[model samples]
Target: MHPINLNEPATTRPTLAESLSFTCQLGECRSELLPLLSEVSKVVSGEGSLSKTLKLVLELMQKHLQVTRAMISLYDASCDQIFIHESFGLTKDEIEKGVYYPGEGITGKVVETRQPIIVPVIADEPLFLNRTGSWDKTVDCRLSFICVPIMRGMKVMGTIGVERLYNNRQLLYLDLEVLAIIATTIAQAVELHLLERAHKQVLQAQSARLDKELKEKFKPANIIGNSKAMQSVYRMIDKVSHARTTVLILGESGVGKERVASAIHYNSSCGGGPFVKFNCASLPESVIESELFGHEKGAFTGAAARRAGRFEEADGGTIFLDEVGELSLSAQAKLLRVIQERCFERLGSNESIKVNVRILAATHCDLTAMVAKGTFREDLFYRLNVFPITIPPLRERGNDILILAEHFNAWFAKEQQADVPAISTPALNLMLNYDWPGNVRELENMMERAVLLAEEGVIHSYHLPAALQPAVLGELGEQSGLEARLSMMEYELIVEALARFQGNMSRAAAQLGLTRRMLGLRMAKYQLNYKDYRCGD
Candidate 1:
């Protein structure tokens, strides 16, 4: 087939009949072509989506050319195939199944060659494979197939094709010309759409990279402690993060259970996947199942639309079920199935959905105790207890209290945009002595409050909560009688003096209004390490 140059003038003057036919075709083309171009130009310049624009183009093709079916097949570079992306007069099933490899059929050949193909009759064209299943051979003898390549420079990005009823052969040529022009106009829109999509992908990749870096920087290692208990927790996190095993984080409330769960997720192989968290205790029994497993549209009174639950959303990622012990027995039964089979059905639907999510459950309550009491399922407990990590309470973490205090102090100071203050020795002692009933959460809150209250670049004992004062002093008082309390007071005074005097025993004794021998006896009685005081000085 020779290329008909749209720009080339006719070689000779037209005959009377040829001129009349050309005028009739021109009138038909102007009526349909002007509106098509106007609508397409608006779509290309405006914020209309690529699908809507393509569908409009196909609809115009059918209306103008008496087309039976029109479709656009977009090139997928990843799969090295062309698949129908948008179409007119094709069912959803047909559109979904329409796929053609490069050079597979007439459409594929057009894409491969970067040229157009015109089939005068479908029955005579061996290359027409009718892959879309929309073509009926019994009564379609008059169907003329025309496909044009949608190009971006020399590259064939996709193909636009239409099936129109055969009429005059001369009119068929004009139709081919119109289709080529329309395809060229649609190509620009497709190019812009692809570029916009590529830009979004690049931005998303950058965002994901930044998010991953932040997660890595603030992982469990940044939990502000090097205590033996914390070190053990870190070791457990390292071991559990690499596996897809179920993790049961056991700890009292406010012990940083959620922090542990986050650490496990961000350090794992599936870190690139999402980290979905749901609090079982926060949702009521009636809604807990729907929240975990999702619900179909109209499944319940308030379910307005189909929803994907935490498990479904966490597919190929990690889902942290905080306060797992609060799940109802029915919910537990469904959760056990998900843990055992990696599949579950949404509420009010029988279709099972499979997920490859890691489970990280946490609770302050003892599952073992709950199981014995019949409130929790024993089978589910055993399933979730594959690996257990118990975070130590703040009261039992020893010197981690001071470490955490200093960390929180600096953090709060920065947050408040104020100068960070030093913790006075008296303040430090008071904090170390108090039993943190609310655990790490309470300690953090106290530190934040102290930072806000501190004004003199030093967090004095008075800056802390007033309740902590009585608690620390009462604990010491209860542990000793009146004589012992007097001895402790004397010891504290001597220690302060020694620190003030740079650990010089004579100067310390002078400051304390005592002889060197009496001061030494008091220090020995209290087991005061003089070297510790000297180092501070």
Candidate 2:
């Protein structure tokens, strides 16, 4: 009989049950096939892994149907090819060779047509390409091939194929009938495997994207300064960011201590964990302990329920205590215990709770002075001072004033939905001469106020705060003469040049279009020190 091909139009193709009539006439009763189908169903639907369950199904087919070899090939949509995923009675090397594009061989044809195919005699069928080499036709020429599409509803997922000794056309039809039912059972397991793999890939992609965003946000470059002092701070931040060492951030108030703490936290090994921030100076002495270490219910007059402290909230992460020197001696002692033992007792709670937390503390006050004054604990100061980073006051940062002003101008402009205004010459000179005792935070606030007032798209001297205006300087009895202003501007230009060149006087003078002698005379006039602008300053 010609090789059976059910690769016809859906309406014309006979159903698999109707095709089994020939097997019934050949004495392979349909009732007898129920046991084999039941066994395959149990194996495929079992709780084992996909690969193991599919492997067992193939072995069952070989044992019950007298099949010589069998394989379950899965469709890889990415490559548009089918590869053997599980097999029985085939060597590993043979399975490696069993890859086929759609419609390339018997297995590929079954996948493409979404139908069954029966090759009565392998030696006579040119389409039986034996790509796997397991079926050597020269040695065994009496083998028959049966392949059926493994489908999920109307969609074809892959194919399953079997090889058996050629008995007659009736028995070949019987083998086809048995294998088709097994392919149906295998489809559910394959679909679930594909879905699980897709879900894992999505999660992995999201994690990678978030990690990249965090790295970009915390890079030292985002701090927005190129002056020698700020560069030194950047180097320090980079060095301590990957360790668990306690860091003492020493800077004047409003110097962006919290910003620096965040940079270290997001770049450290605990980057993905929570970052809890508490200002030690913001709370009063009466409730500071409860705020730090949670109080039990009814522990105090206002304590209504149990609460988690900052340390407990920061478990497996970091806690940033701004103005740590402001904490009372009692709180300081508790903090010291947490730092040394990684454990502490909550307020009014006798039981000590443990945690894993990295501590980062900041203060504008001198801890050594506080310790000397008998206010701050000396041991806590030593514990918190493992690594110290000092951010320079804004006045010493030279042209970083201009850089930060421009950044804040553009940023606030976008935030307030206004045009980014230009900084007029007088405004630039005024900003250069201001002491900026409030540091970067003062500069940010001034720029925001200036952006609001510079409605004409240009920031003039009058748009700045009274602290940076000439009229205000005159009212405050500060120098405001044109000669004094010119001298200040000249001194600022010299400082910017020196800072940019790392205090190389020759380069700094060349950049200013002046001789080294003239540059030194001007620096001497303003009492500006070049050594202070050096790299390690």
Candidate 3:
């Protein structure tokens, strides 16, 4: 079986796409696959910045493939060693301790053997690499792993690597195949990464480097956070970026859910893929369907040309529907059918247009409550919620408040080309104290305003909106005690790391630099259960 056969006879083996939704559902997995392969050619020619490309690639792996992490370790042909060239979600300690290496580990063994190996449980795998004599100090408790040789023709480039979850359940054969696909894609991309670097060097040496000017297309940029909450978002993105799953992003207004959606599509296995976006709330009933699914020429009064809809235009890539909660019942039903079947008909045309689109949706409204109220269809909710991710409101994410404020300050300063200025102590305190009802979005707007208004070298409290800057020093007294708030903040940050790392206490601890036991005790104290919150849709 091709592993993509949608319908399988009961006696015959079930197809790989049978369990997976996108390949079979879209009826054009080949179309999707070839495009991504072709995209590598474009990626090679695009740039020579290894870090930017690798960072973007790793981020995409998180979004598209649903894999916890991805790596492109290469065989240093000259040095006869494996270089842990690029990775995401791996800690500094792990990478240094031969996480993926020729330094006495499984990857090294795989390179030595020139064959792929599957360890359903890392614990049970033979002792090939023992950088650490035993598992006593290794942060990697992730036992389910697969290492495939990155071969260029018959020559092995390096080892393409993947792990299921941290300390996860045993890896099934099916999971092995999944890892193989990831390895195949990554091996190809990494090879291109190397070729790109070489070509970039050639261009730079010749002074023939092309000027890369990116137009400000108003696609969301700089949705920054490395805190536990954002890490959780990064993980969820890792899980579903490449797959054709229906993703539902839930968050309050200004939580940057749309930005997150864009990240998912751009970082998924389809990072090079086209991204088509529609604000469902902005359009009326008659236009919404036509705009999203497309309309034929003369289908509507002003429909002069046969235009491809967002779904078709985003073929082999992603289509993001923002504010999907606002969709009318009839529209919701049609959306549900399209999501379920991956086929739609243009207005005034009975012929079905099949598109290879990965669907990502975001809404500030609570779909569960809406479903309960009969405003949203339960079926649509179920389809979209196959993978559901929630972005925490600003108030809930602890000191990320300050971190994001700093990020926005820098970004807005550059955007508006205001000479960069530091925030005054009073201004910083005001921002940290305010409960951002609009989350990151609100903070960004406030920073933009402050940067514009500040005539002096520093942003002061007086420049902030009246709601944020109160004259009375006593206003701070009305909120929770600072000590108590900091304690809760510390507690939440710990829990977020645990969840973000998929309960890998060691990696989570590395991110926080706390002992695994220390992190656990805090979890026990706070009574936090964050297992489901870590990995994304």
- Point to the candidate with the largest lDDT: 2
- RMSD of candidate 3 to the truth, in angstroms, is 27.5
- Model 3 / residue 444 / CA error / Å: 1.0
For model 3, residues 169-281, the per-residue Cα lDDT tens digits are 21133444454555555554454445434433443443321112112222224465445666677678767766767889999998888888887777678768788889998
Superpose all Cα atoms of candidate 2 onto the true structure and report the RMSD in Å to 1 decimal: 25.8
Which run of 10 residues does model 1 get worst, by summed lDDT?
A: 1-10
Give candidate 3 misplaced runs (Cα > 4 Å): 1-222, 471-537
Whichever of 1 and 2 has more TM-score, that candidate is 1
For model 3 the TM-score comes to 0.47
- Global lDDT of each model? 0.77, 0.79, 0.65
**Candidate 2 C-alpha lDDT tens digits along 275-393:** 99999989898888888888899888988999989999999999999999889888999899999999988877899999999999999998898899999988999999999999999
Regions more than 4 Å wrong, model 2: 1-221, 471-537
Each prediction's TM-score versus the true structure:
0.51, 0.49, 0.47
Candidate 2: Cα lDDT at 173: 62
Per residue, candidate 1 scores C-alpha lDDT tens digits across 116-217 of 877878877778888878888897877888888988656678988888676655565666667777777777557544543443354346546645654543
Worst 10 residues of 3 by lDDT: 209-218
Per-prediction tally of clashes: 0, 0, 14
